[model samples]
Target: MFGKKSRYYGLATVRNTDRQGRIVQAVKLRRLPAAGGVETVVTDGSQLDVMSEHQYRDGARFWHIADANSELEAGELVETTGRVINVPKR
Candidate 1:
């Protein structure tokens, strides 16, 4: 099982723990497609290592999913759930 794991796999936040140790926060994923198109990210930390302002922004924008793939010709706030990595266990 260990050998089958993705190299980019690592701990990811699945909730927003509060100061009191309560899940008051939202979840977060670990790995992301690297800038060079390689799906890579550090896999030794409990949290996703530092991400630049732009890098973080791009991640947010890419979290889009949709139905049967199709070409776009206009603009709209469509709901989507495209390729999404499962939030790793704590």
Candidate 2:
């Protein structure tokens, strides 16, 4: 379960059986809102969580940055140093 401030918070979870016939609960997909943001250059050792904390004051919101930049993985987004990334406005 996600925290109150999490993007996935309060999303409906549906029960389903996987190919292996195991029951699982999955969160429903939710569309992200379109928003404008500013670009910032990442330095060596830069991390998405730190960047999120700096920009949004919530490290758990790093996915916002990833989503804004079309990155499906946070590691993929922050692994490259000196890369320009979008920091979405709250």
Candidate 3:
């Protein structure tokens, strides 16, 4: 289960039988919203949390930016210097 502030917090949990005949419990896939936002370059040594703090005022909300940009692996957003990423509006 996720915390109240987690992106997955309010998602529905589903139970499914896996190919191995095991029951698996998992949260449903979270759909990304269509957001209009500003683009920012990933500066050297910059992290998503830092960017989130500047944009959303809550570092834990970095997923908001990641979700807006359809990033499955958030770390990839900052893996390269000068890479541009979308920062969702508050």
Candidate 4:
């Protein structure tokens, strides 16, 4: 038997950077939660835009918004909220 639980969503940042610069760089999108962060396509490995942006002041991680959806306008606020699903062994 198996059991599952519900989890809430919080703000996290997606860390990525533009494909420019001499040594490459990164930047923060600021105030994006875990779910929103996922939507964020952080190019950087850590998505820590270290070269282009700064870290959170209150110890919060970087975050990014989800990609554009036809249902959504040019800009809309969205988030990721759900329990962390654990993958079972095959």
Candidate 5:
């Protein structure tokens, strides 16, 4: 159900029962990797995808930055201007 480049691709899935008592299959939670990255300052109106494009030449690779900093929500990385964020080295 996921593309080859998707982070969830090849991950194990588990059957889960929701409150309605229906069985649902869900991808296993992916753990954040212990990554070392360079510290980058968030510029005005900075965005994760844009930063990813600038750094990795692929906007879809924004997850690398998020995972590097252990942030579940990637947007959190660019929310504050001038804030220092970790950008994973490619």
Candidate 6:
């Protein structure tokens, strides 16, 4: 289950059998929206989850921030402190 603010939230899950013949329920990958957001400066020890909580009031929506910034991973986006990042509008 995903959080309310998650992009995958409310998306129907598809059940599929892997090579091992094990059933797995997965959400299809979706293309993220184009980057359009306000710029924000990251302070010391800033993390994506924390920025999400601050910008969107939901820490679980950190992926939104990463996607908006065209980052493949949240960790990569937040790896550097004092960097300018984009916080997407919900």
Clashes of each: 4, 0, 0, 17, 0, 0
TM-score, candidate 6, is 0.60
Q: Rank the candidates by TM-score, best first.
A: 3, 5, 2, 6, 1, 4
- lDDT per prediction? 0.29, 0.83, 0.86, 0.26, 0.86, 0.81
Task: Provide the lDDT at 68 for model 4.
Answer: 20
- Per-model TM-score on C-alpha atoms: 0.20, 0.66, 0.76, 0.16, 0.75, 0.60
lDDT (Cα, 0-100) at 48 in candidate 3:
86
Candidate 4 per-residue lDDT, tens place, 38-69, comes to 22323323222231234233212212111122
RMSD of each predicted structure:
16.8, 2.8, 2.3, 18.1, 2.2, 3.7
Clash pairs of candidate 5?
none
Kindly report the root-mean-square deviation of model 2 from the true structure over all alpha carbons: 2.8
User: Worst 10-residue stretch by lDDT in candidate 5?
Assistant: 28-37
* Candidate 4: stretches off by over 4 Å: 1-10, 22-90
Clashing pairs in 1: 16-25, 65-80, 65-81, 65-82
Report the C-alpha lDDT of model 3 over 1-90, residue by residue, as the tens digit.
889977578899999999999999999877666889998998999898998999888998888888878567989999999988889889
lDDT of 6 by residue, 1-90 (tens): 799977679987888999999999988766766778888877778888888898889998887787777566678776777778888887
Deviation (Å) of 56 in candidate 1: 17
lDDT of 3 at 74: 88
lDDT of 6 at 40: 84
- lDDT tens digits, residue span 23-90, model 5: 99988877766777889999889998988999899998998898888557788888888989899889
Q: Best-fitting candidate, measured by TM-score? A: 3
Task: Give the clashing residue pairs of candidate 6, or none.
Answer: none
lDDT assessment of candidate 6: 0.81
lDDT of candidate 2 at residue 1, scale 0 to 100: 80
